[model samples]
Target chain A: MSTPSTSSAPAEAGPRDKHALAAAIARDVPDGAYVNLGIGQPTLVAEHLREGSGVVLHTENGMLNFGPVATGDDVDLDLTNAGKIPVTELPGAAYFHHADSFAMMRGGHLDVCVLGAFQVSANGDLANWHTGAPDAIPAVGGAMDLAIGAEQVWVMMTLFAKDGTAKIVPTCTYPLTGLACVDRVYTDLGTFELAASRGRADGAVVVRDLSGISLEELGGRLDVPVVLG
Target chain B: MSAASILASYADAVADVEDGATVLVGGFGMAGMPVELIDALIEQGAKDLVIVSNNAGNGDTGLAALLAAKRVRKVVCSFPRQSDSWVFDGLYRAGQIELEVVPQGNLAERMRAAGAGIGAFFCPTGVGTPLTEGKETRVIDGRTYALEYPIKGDVALIKAHRADTMGNLVYRKTARNFGPVMATAARTVIAQVSEVVPLGGLDPEVVVTPSIYVDRVVCPTAQES
Candidate 1:
């Protein structure tokens, strides 16, 4: 493995260093799991771990056991994540065939995959790729593999975009990545789960806001009924 | 003769196809291509079909419908977006589907090569990584390149804005995705269009895909939900 920061001590591992949502994700992730953390906000989960736990991180571009973001200038050019960002390779990490990496995804070998989304439907439908907007740059990469291949799908995103628009909606107008693929959704607001109802076997998904946002406040932006807790 | 050799409405034409056929969908992300026809294929219950697209849709719409129905057994795509957790994350966790991910550029080239009747081509994509497994690799210019075979399908589903009676097609804006290349890559090319015009109505220069490749055309259905 490549060593970029051997001099510095590992950052303090605890929940306070992370926000509430990050703490929730750390709580959900199990030990000795093969995990693929999606790019963007999902990558932040790497920064917070339960210290001394074994979580093998896999990057789609052929990397395993990558460390969190850079702490100092100790960078390794050869080792990086899927997004081409410099990442530290943890101990006991080894390089494998890229095909094997995909095989781990395609062959149902992944334990968990944390991702970001634009809109998550009440029925657990995901439509974060194409918004069907006129100028939207359309692309839906590995989202499918991580969506269907992983044993558990956990989403981490803000309740709304920077524009104050709700990222979670009743239905996704954009092109979908998978149907009812979401198992659990985590946001800055609260957590949500898909429940079964009469008509839909998978049932209606309910969003429980923990961020103190009133149900009526979230109801106005979303099309589904909010079961206030 | 294949049904591709005889057809009037692409909507009515694909009824002859049986289940379990492989489909190659063309486009880069949500760029130019036939989206309308994809809906029809789904409604047509083209079950057990192997689908090739850029990426699976995020949720209930687009390519995700097939995934939800469990109709697609294998998916061959290039770029699976990470930002959207809807499809890739969901399916990856359930372990219900098979994925063959190639580099975005290599994916497009392989599709192009298939349509152009090329057996195989070489590129540096997926060489050093795991993408090179069970495949041939060659060195060019002292750099390693993998031999990627052409990707063709039993049925080619495409979407376009306008078409002539002879099957010449035109795309509008980002919809022009993968139109030209995908048209020639399949044994049967089924197209869906918003409008169909007389053969001479379209300008010869603007036609992206010639009528020679298209076998049928269907008007957009309003009830496609």
Candidate 2:
């Protein structure tokens, strides 16, 4: 949905905070979808999803249909998400062996999976599990499985790293979690989709929504070029 | 029926584990950790152990205590680092311990394969990632997958809510994670349960882990301050 503009007006401000970005992403999730929220920022998507949305949340730890963060006497130390935060089991929730839970993951039973990314390439290559630091111990965890197994992979992360470097890169220097698996990028700055071009190996990133930054200003901030929707 | 699998003490349950033994510790964080068995292992002070678990540990107990005591040589796990996993982080940063980070799905499948008598399986989980490096890759039905090997353990330390004298176990809620599968993958399985009941007391339909897989069952005593 686009608003036709006769004159060049600055695009509206992008998402102001992480919560806004998470809400932006949550609005796009369809009803009755089986979704897995990765650890970290992606976990917040659960809190922002439209109430009674019929979205079934899957945790790699072996529970499904768990409710939001547990509080007071509702907290069960054993019942937790992949992030190890206490959660409540909703009515009709089911538990299974770890293998069966993973089977649900690796068998493509999930409709969508929201993940956190360190760097996402123009061609949708994902690098999240490791930073490629010499002294850093690379922990793959369940990220690799969720990235490749889900039907659509949505990455929720800040547009830039703490050092002011663009996380959306022309090519990733970090170790990859999956090759060309990311479907959309949800950031505090804006939301983007990967647009592949003919005869080009690396595709272009098209901004579908803006928060506070204009197209030209957003392009000026990055090393790579970005297209406006 | 044969003799009951009940053991008199936690120490006796874990007595056969030796130096450099590979152990599968079942839990998804602190939920199903065999706390009593871990305490016994800590008291026993076995060294150079290789552990396979979902996480390193929470706070300073269970696997963390063993690791803090410098008893573990390596850890093959899915998620080894957590906010409360300072013990593992310290040991890992110091280069005192080795780490093998496997994808959670791959880790679970490998353990299941060990118990199921399967040699290896092709899984697409880690393909196109650094985890796939040095591993065999094959294209099946136009999709690339990595060949993962089964992971067997010398002993498995598991937790359950209840166990029958015959060693059949029943787990509770999400605490059941990895316990039943680990039992099948190990040469010896020692389960710490809250209660032990007579063989016929437990319903046959509800047994999560069959009696054939468990070697010893121990009920943890009340903790002393």
Candidate 3:
């Protein structure tokens, strides 16, 4: 059927705060690298980044040299980002043809891209946009670009939704933006890496470590099965 | 469905837009933007317009063309990077271009809400800060949130990878950046597509933005700009 369908109720996953997970993923982004910050919690990655890392931030709006958040007198009302807020511009940054900017993305020049995810399958299918809900907003923005354009796609999201369902599923029933595109997943419970395999047989998503939280307690907050390895 | 008019020529596409109008161009830094439409807008001398985009391009290209023409009166985006040129810094110092800056995430949510017909919503992003000043505030769960207004546009300019005659768009990678959302949030949505396909040819599930929200289409020649 043309109509996309999913359960009205959110899947039950463990309780987790997204901000903490976002912070964890931010730690992974190295210094002096070209990065595209996706919308949603991923944008906060810039705020949490360490100073003097020489990280060059690229927004789809056309920017390269941006410093840490604006503070005190540095806040220029006119020098803002695609989001159109006052931001600090670093020295030696240049704006060029936006087509060249996309060329950078499609050309696979970005080092890392942090994106928000709705569902990440065990086999590494990334589906961030379009939940198939009729009531949900019907649009997918730069996510498609960030997913495939960046060399590494790191998804920052909570382990579960408000209804306690695991966003990290075995298979994504919704439309996918990229196949086997995810590199790692950072959730409140801990971090998980999709065990790579030869083909689409669906690899196992193994949680590397837990932060002093029990699996049973964490599983209580999710709708999907959480196997403790 | 009424037969959607195909953009047979670039001149026809440029004619629909006027000078000095509030124009919201889709894309983030530079991905997913319609370079051809931007060129046409520049060629048409549509100056002094309120330009809303994620960020201005590096220099003398993309949205910078409008900025160069001195056609842009104001820019409303989440963040404006300073490395592009000293002119923007001077403009801010001189207050020539008023920049209404919102947090990047909040800006996207506000745009999404505007497109979804939501009047307003509360979020803790800007509460208890200068960003909250002069805006509504509410306390929930012992925490305060700033009441953010929705974002809408008079004209939303977007670029898609492929578009069916029905206007259903399929964006390729980063090019999908704010294109779909900008398409719906604007009073009039204009798109520039690399390829125009038949209606049924595009899979329904793959279509990101439905044709119902689209009003005009501009096809760019393959010649590199």
Candidate 4:
């Protein structure tokens, strides 16, 4: 929402738009890697993948080697992503049932996965499934599996909540999805990496890139310890 | 011999469904949802059912309509809340229906364990999370895992792309989710396919589900085709 105007906006503004954030994360994806993009904002990474990158897309609903979004006659209700949107199949596309599909993840067959998170603790504990709010219907689709299964779990989200509260905190108040699972975070304002310690409260945050904020201001905003990568 | 009975009508297919049956309904959403069969089950008037699925319901149709009819007593699924799931949201808030949310992969693999005749398995999916609370936890090879049990169903209603007269089934793309596994996990498996081929019409190698797992087959769409 902090994206500046095309002509006068600073190259590195306060917060980049979702498209720019997606492009940055998509570029970070290694070549020839198998990746799963979570539903919602993370799904945009698929469209920005480099051409001929050989990046195979996996959907938890039972598909691999799937291509970008399908339009026109290419649309098939049966062929879709984890988000259940119409998608295309690559030449080496394969389809299995839900069991085999999740096996690809829980069996350590995936290279990376990008997920959205509500809160990420200093030690990389992720809490995205539920807010623990009253009258909330908690729905966790392959989050727990994907969190622990992927070789590297990258998060794509906003750095702060709408009320200006930092989501990257010393501890998370939401129900935990996975303990010490996140490796990196790509947000609207900045990017960060975590020296994650599983089951331990000692996590060191590293600021990899910054757009709109200074290191001092960012550190002041967050309660956790952070340093330059 | 295969126990697959070819039924002429979808309503007759689900007529024998008794009350309090734990049914596994297959689909990732609307892709492989057995809409006609569910409509038929609604007409069949079976009540107090436990529905197992990946999602509770999306819109006001298929499983949503089933929930709307006050037939389901509980839903055992991974994801029950979605933007279009107002019907389930209403029922859940009113405390009329009970819910058990499992992780998506665990939901699939649990049924797979049942189909494979495995007693129980240790999985790292929900380790140290609230989803695995009160369950047995083990340290295997230095990694933590929670003990998981199989989820067997009394009846499984699924949709497939094609099925042979012998009940060998194949599914289309992502729509194939939970169908093949549910077929084996259930005591009685019923399938609604778009096409019904002859016994030898389908190749054996590409068949996702063999005839041994299926109990019945119906093709209302084939008549339309």
Q: Highest lDDT among the candidates is held by which one?
A: 4
The prediction achieving the highest DockQ against the true structure is 4
lDDT for predicted candidate 4 compared with the true structure = 0.89
How should the candidates be ordered by DockQ, best one leading? 4, 2, 1, 3
Greater DockQ among 2 and 4 belongs to 4
What TM-score does structure 3 among the candidates reach?
A: 0.51
Q: Which runs in model 2 stand beyond 4 Å of their true positions? A: A1-12, A195-202, B1-4, B220-225
Give the least accurate 10-residue stretch of model 3 chain A, judged by summed lDDT: A5-14
Between candidates 3 and 4, which one is better according to DockQ? 4
How well does candidate 1 score on lDDT at residue A128? 56
lDDT of 4 at A117: 97
* Steric clash pairs (candidate 4): none
RMSD of each: 19.4, 4.4, 18.3, 3.1
lDDT tens readout by residue for model 1, B1-225:
322232334456567656888787754344433555566566777787778776665445557665776778778776554454366556755777677765544555577788788989765444433445778888878755668788888887776778776778876533444555667778888777777776598999888788778877666431221
Where does model 3 sit among the CAPRI classes? incorrect
- At residue B207, give the lDDT of candidate 3: 80
- Per-residue error for A124 in candidate 4, Å, reads 1.1
RMSD of 4: 3.1
| Model 1 TM-score (2 dp) | 0.48
The TM-scores, chain A only, for the candidates as listed are: 0.80, 0.89, 0.78, 0.91
